[model samples]
Target: MNSHEGRPAGLRERTRRAVQAEIVATAMRLFLEHGFEATTMEQIANDVGISRRSLFRYFGTKEDIVLGDHAEHGLALRAALEARPADESPWEALRAALKSLFESLPYAPEEFIKITTMLHASPSLRARQLEKRQQWAELLMPDIAARLGEATDPMTRLRAHALVACALACSEAATDAWVHSNGTIDMERAYDEAVAAVRG
Candidate 1:
């Protein structure tokens, strides 16, 4: 038998995921209490009862800790877009994919608002947020190019980038409206209206 035969597959992945979640949770709490600039990796590691080196193994920087969940969201958004029915128009598929991705958020709307507020208040975080959106656009490009039946054309690539940019803009606008309303506005409705406006 092999040296490691019969072990459960993905056990290492599961453990890594668990540790990452713990680090994120701890870092978020510290950031909320002390502000992002004031928080340190050492403090986060100490709070989570791990060494700074161990923390670095999971995240490369403080910004990564703050925006870690966003990376997952980008991946999920790409998957949602890719899984959309081929018969659906690009605009419709984009709208449905955004809605589905938003609905799958593990946190409540209030928590999202808090995170948004934090991001807006921090220049570094806002930069990271834009970077994440750009990454999403990159992720969506190939799928969009295929969906539009112009997989190898330069115009198709530009169009795909424009569509993803528009979607990201709509999402930002909806988030701004929600924040301005103090969470009284329904996020789903706001996002839907924003997307529809873009489609028109």
Candidate 2:
């Protein structure tokens, strides 16, 4: 049984969140200033006023800094999908999750544009991010398979994969559109449009 399940969660959870947020903040600053490849773990550690070993306690590698919370994002999406009305279609549930994500970000369009730029500018990071997305797909696949039950044959898995791929592709397209429009367009709208196109 999870300790957090029963009690009102306490200081440890708060501390963990604050520490993780600080790590991401510090790492993002370094990444933007020096470029991802040029930034070193030692520099990040020094900048954060910690030993290299200590930094590793928070993040094992530089790539991990960028992709660390990606798994958590998947989990959140799953939770969001689960919360949608039981009668909701999978695509509809996924659309709700996308909307929730777009709404949850605190950054301005310019900031998000820069993040997308940085991710693409670094080849290794891009590859790593893609790999992470694939890993997320695998994590999600089982749930989708179970949802489809006996109907979830190989062809069903293929369709489910395609749906997941389509969602991702829409997200990327929306980001590109957001960047190109210079904060003029609504990202949520772009995402909605992409999903609509894919569903159609």
Candidate 3:
């Protein structure tokens, strides 16, 4: 075996990740507390006790800090879709995957509501969010095409696009309903109703 193969666990990697997470968390809190445009990189760096240069090393731009690392999520979602039983229809697979996704939403509903509310009010962040979702749709389309067995066809691509769009629309509507209700109702129920509206 190569000498590097049996090396001790990488302490640097863990430390770097800890620092990065702290920076991102601080940025998010700042962004929520103050408007996105008002929260400067210097403020984030200061809050995290790091140099601005060090902060840039971890995230090139402020937007990257708030978005939290979605590149890995697409790969994981595709893998989940691929592992789904072959007999299931594309819609079925997508619905099941989405249910899992909704149930496992990373942040608390309150946090998501705050972040999304901020995003919705800000033009630059709104554009970035759209771009990120577009990238995710592009990443997912091919796998979906293969599963639906129309890899070479435009119609399949359209369907996949529509499906992702529909899902996002439903989730966003439900999120709005949840937020406007101010924690008085179960957000999961709102999400389910949104999905049902799409299904019907």
Residue range with the least summed lDDT across 10 consecutive positions in model 2: 142-151
lDDT for 63 (candidate 3) = 82
lDDT scores in order = 0.86, 0.78, 0.76
Residue 197 of model 3 has an lDDT of 79
Off by over 4 Å in 3: 1-9, 183-200
**Which residue pairs collide, candidate 3?**
none
RMSD of each: 2.2, 4.0, 2.8
TM-score of each: 0.89, 0.81, 0.82
Query: Tens-digit lDDT track for model 2 on 7-66?
Result: 556776787778778888998988988889899999988887778998888888898898
Best by TM-score: 1
Q: What lDDT is reached at residue 178 by model 3? A: 76
* Clashing pairs in model 2, backbone N/Cα/C closer than 3 A: none
Ranking by lDDT: 1, 2, 3
lDDT of 3 at 38: 96
Candidate 1 residue spans exceeding 4 A from truth: 3-10, 196-200
What C-alpha lDDT does candidate 2 achieve relative to the native structure? 0.78
Model 1, residue 82: C-alpha shift (Å): 1.8
